[model samples]
Target: MTTSLTIAVKRIHDAAAASDGARFLVDRLWPRGVSREKAALAAWLKPLSPSDALRKRYHGETADSDEAWDAFRLDYFEELDAGGEEAKAALFTLDAAAKVGPVTLLYAAKSAERNNALALREWLERRTR
Candidate 1:
């Protein structure tokens, strides 16, 4: 049977609410100044995050141009497609939780528009369709 998933993206620094449901931190590294207790995460799915090289490359970019964003997303999707067992396990776990109820993907990026969590949510949404 197929299950519908409610995937929402939010900043890790923001206050968590009951509506957030099962919160998963999608950043590979923990957000600065946010304690584990404050994060209130059900799990930190680092394996689902972009590779260090890709992240660093994107960060080095001078501007958040559409071209850069597109490249980042394409590279990120490729990484997800070629990911190994750990990544697969993380995605499986995420899918399981999302199947049961709403899920919020938390990220620490300052830009709400161009973050890995957003890319990941888009990726997941596409696959579910």
Candidate 2:
């Protein structure tokens, strides 16, 4: 397996041409306004997403506030660290995929920087090092 992995984040609704590498959906919920054919997903790894309670508390109205966002990131990081078996499995699968090529984490979040996919990517990069 590759010691380092090349990971990228993309919106599920982005142009199909932007699709690259082994595509995986890291969102717990399917994106609205996007068809399955358009998604062209290889897998939907909901186990990698934040817990339902965490997600609900931080998203929608709360997700718009910087303070909430910061808190969300902090809480989400804790969740990732304590994410246990499912998170480990997701990371393992991602690492394995990267051995062959790049791995693109597909998410529906409007904020590319604040989304779970970014957190997951950051977490994986840190672990691989």
Candidate 3:
């Protein structure tokens, strides 16, 4: 994609302030206490979220960041390669709009340190390159 893709962890409000062009939501589950209209999302990619197992395993903080990342990649591959039809559709929006505007992946999560959005950004970068 010619246009840059920004993946950031933020609440919808923070995303609003930071993202001025195109905004895409990348969470499997919608944030609690948030309405669909309030999300102000251009697109939502639920398939990109961490799997249930991974979430449960690394609910908050954990010792195995590397292992969690590896498992996350495996799960992401399943979303991108195997039964990833929806995943393709989600990513395709960004790919298709490469030249028109900035693309930001908005994630509604508390932990900005480590999460699915970061993993997704890396994975997308590696594959796109």
Candidate 4:
């Protein structure tokens, strides 16, 4: 039998919902205005986030380009594949949570479509397939 993991992605600034389940903040930096209470996170998995260099290149330099998005996904996947023990532990935490119920990955980016949380959700779903 296979368990279908329900992983949702949302902005940290948005109002938390009951459907969000185990909310994990998958960003390297804390969001500007949200307090710890406001975030109500199950965990802050910084190790699962993209490297600062990759983030800057994507957001600061080539945000509008399609090629950049592709490159970012490729590079980000590589990073996750080659990540350290901390990342592995964080992934394990997410996996454990998913086994119990749903999980929501939270991020601070302005773009609703393109962010590390979405990328990480894709990565997680791919691994489960």
Candidate 5:
């Protein structure tokens, strides 16, 4: 399977429109002001978001690094390793079906540079590679 990650809002809409496409919102909290219908998401994979403690610790912090990921793996097992695995599997099923376009992973965060989406995208890309 081939997949890529992007952060543009318009790109997300475009990806979701393509054939074999699915959009998963990987955030614990729903983005403010966006309705479910308006979001047009196939799934809200909140279980894939970082834990509250981790979010508080890592958000806006540049100190978060590879070691942070290791710490997260231990603490994030229940949410990510277990629940997220299932969500990711489902997304991959969508990917397999989507032979034409990219599967967009969306997020509702103000910080575009440092958010769960980037981390999750990094993790998934590394694994897929």
Candidate 6:
């Protein structure tokens, strides 16, 4: 990976004002009320998202609980590690985009700080270093 690689996370509902680099939807399920045209996504990398069971277990309701969130974060990372080919494919896609410039990961979670995109960004950064 290039030292210049940059990763950013943003909500899907947010307006996209820039065309500086790749934009990908990192959620396993397509965001509600967002059309494909409006999304303007380069890719919808479901493989990069948390599994259904994990997502359900750590839904938006868990955000307020630090302990739950911590446990979710740990479990999520484990899933990413054990994700095998799926995780590898997503990482490859991210790496390819990052080589050129910034790669923005879009998610639908209401809590910006408690989403998989943030976790994925951290995991990717660690791998890049």
**Residue-pair clash count for candidate 6:** 0
- The better-scoring model by TM-score among 2 and 6 is 6
Model 3 spans > 4 angstroms off: 3-9, 13-15, 60-83
TM-score for each predicted model, relative to the true structure: 0.95, 0.85, 0.74, 0.95, 0.61, 0.91
Q: List the residue pairs that clash in candidate 5.
A: 20-98
Model 1 alpha-carbon drift over 4 Å, by segment: 1-3
Write the residue-wise lDDT of candidate 2 on 83-115 in tens digits. Answer: 788777877777677888888888998997688
lDDT of each residue in 1-129, candidate 4, tens digit only: 024888899999999999999999999999999999999999999999999999888887677687888789899999999989999999889888888888999999898888888888888778877
Local error of candidate 5 at residue 1 (angstroms): 3.4
Q: Distance from true position, residue 30, model 5, in Å?
A: 1.1
Return the candidate ranking by TM-score, descending.
Answer: 1, 4, 6, 2, 3, 5
TM-score of 6: 0.91
In angstroms, the error of model 3 at 62 is: 1.7
Which pairs, if any, clash in model 1? none
Per-model lDDT: 0.90, 0.80, 0.64, 0.89, 0.59, 0.83
Total backbone collisions, model 2? 0
RMSD of 3: 3.1
Q: Give per-candidate clash totals.
A: 0, 0, 0, 0, 1, 0
Per-residue lDDT for 75 in model 2? 83
Distance (Å) between predicted and true CA of 53, model 3? 3.1
Model 1: per-residue Cα lDDT over 1-109, one tens digit each: 0336788899999999999999999998999999999999999999999999999999999538999999999999999989899998998888888877899999999
For every candidate in turn, the CA RMSD to the true structure comes to: 1.4, 2.2, 3.1, 1.5, 5.1, 1.6
What does candidate 5's lDDT look like per residue over 1-129, in tens digits?
A: 554543223222233454424677777777777767766777776667776777766554443476665555455544555554666775565456345455666776664554566666666655557
Candidate numbers, best lDDT first, in rank order: 1, 4, 6, 2, 3, 5
lDDT of 6 by residue, 33-106 (tens): 99998888878899989899989888745576988888887888898888888778877888888877788999
On the 0 to 100 scale, the lDDT of residue 60 in model 4 is 75
- Regions of model 5 farther than 4 Å from truth: 3-20, 60-100
